[model samples]
Target: MKLSQLGEFGLIKNARDIFKSLNENIVVGIGDDCAAIKLRKGFLLIATTDALVEGIHFKLDYIQPYQLGIKSININLSDIAAMGGIPLHALLSIAVPPNISVNFMDDFFKGVKDGAKRFKVSIIGGNVSSSKNEFSINMAILGEVKKKYMLLRKGAKAGDKIFVTGYLGDSAAGLEILKRSQKSEVRSQKKRKLIKRHLMPIPRLEEGRFLAVKKLATSMTDISDGLASDIRRICEESDVGANIFTKNIPISKELKDFTSSQLKTRGTHPADGSSKLITSLNFALYGGEDYELLFTAKPENVKKLKELWKNVNIPITMIGEITKKGINLVNIDGKAIPLTKEGYNHFKG
Candidate 1:
């Protein structure tokens, strides 16, 4: 059953039936000229949009339609999470070639439904168009947050402590493994966990909200573009600088093992451990799409923040501190090396 046979109306009807929503905030959902949503009083409305295109963001060989659906929604939700907002509704837009199978769309929507359901988000409406060759998906997510609890990229001040939630570079390392297509590596459970992280990044909504509601975070943003690049955003927005301690940056055990294996495969000995460590550290610093929360907190509140963070399951690490000037990475021996933005750039070429 190809999409060409179903035509546009049939495709939309299928979507309407599949994405039925009971969210009370939605005054009008799918099958309307415009989906109407009622904004809650005393809360600020937050909206964000993102796109995933074939060949650019992902390849069909490496990702399934279902996983693609989940990734698309999760990425957008991350923006909402960064602002300490609760997601309410979504508008999904997709363009596919006419030859695309109906089953493909069904599985994709199933993934979207499951992902949205996890955060209590409703799919209100979207537009479908026929593309010539490639597949593209774009999602606009709507959320709400109390004015007092809303967090932004600004407000980080000098001497504020920097923190990140969870491990970094797992997604980029997973992407590396997928591209290598090593049969043995793919079979390992540890490697599969990396692949899962790359495919379906978990948004740190609870962590973001906790930081916002407790007034713990002075500034915050999700690490979609890697620490090296995103930390610059905070510095630029807040007009401050940062000094990241290399030893404090959290690296997962699996990532260390993966880098070690790569060196061994290249005929390098474990005796030259510095080479392996640097490789893994580079990934933690420059690899994009980690989706973890990168935030700053005033030094005076660090004690209280740490005490309250015990209630959260995910671990938070203090990686660095806000400085007066210059973005630098401080080595173990206290050498400060200037850092650069090496994360994802749409027009780098």
Candidate 2:
């Protein structure tokens, strides 16, 4: 049945049934005017809200409703992780077209429930509204961390070393493949992995928490808007400059192989591959939604960080150093090129 037939109140009732609270701290949940939760006394509360809009942020044709639900929650959880906080509760709000089916809503909510369950978070309450054309989700997440463990983007110093967790460019490349897959008939295991990375990004919560609890990262931010833009955010907040080495920037073997294959298909010579590689590297530098952590640490902490990381299972690479002032991308031969582009811009198109 269409949402227009069920109406808003009936829809709310169904959602309330689906999202009954698992967290005992929630005193008043879904049917109430406000959700009441007992905040732990010793920790600081951190709240973040994010919105995903159809057409702009996502395309329904390429994404399943269930995956959309998980993506929404994961993106918000990433915000908490960036701050070294543990997500506790969430409030979900959605505006969907009345023509959408109830089964679609069920699948979407199931995705939300699964995501919350995976992270041990409670969905206390939310609002649902009818949209004329598009579907949109806005999620607000509440998290907490000890005051001492909380991290910020402003703590990086001029002498700090820069680091990133996991691989880069995969999501962006994956997105490229998704856009091209409709026209091309290329299917490979590497292609699937890249697509999965874009659709179901894993937030670096444990890694972020480790950095916070151990006081390892001097400054940090998640790579939501691409490394080029996010690193600039860190630099801007810390009032410092950076020198990122091109050779030092970590690229996954999957991404490298995919790019080489594409170039070969286009009949590009091996010697001309550097130009093509640079284009692929742009995806790593400027493509958004990698969801990995880009962080800075003191040089002295490098040894300890590497040692601890061995146990954590998250691969980290030291990409560069915090410079005295000015952002430069240094080549393998030691030529410093001024970084000219920022990451994905919503309003710049």
Worst 10 residues of 1 by lDDT: 266-275
lDDT by residue for model 1 over 156-222, one digit each (tens)?
Answer: 9999999999999888778777876854443588788888889999999989999999999999999
Using all chains and alpha carbons, the TM-scores for the candidates as numbered come to 0.95, 0.94
What is the alpha-carbon lDDT of model 1 when measured against the actual structure? 0.88
**Candidate 1: Cα lDDT at 26:** 87
Would you list the clashing residue pairs of candidate 1? none
Candidate 1 residue 273 Cα shift, in angstroms, is 24
Error of 1 at 29 (Å): 0.7
For candidate 2, the per-residue lDDT at 299 reads 97
| Residue range 128-188, candidate 2, lDDT tens digits | 8999999999999999999899999989998899999999988877777776567347678
What's the TM for model 2? 0.94
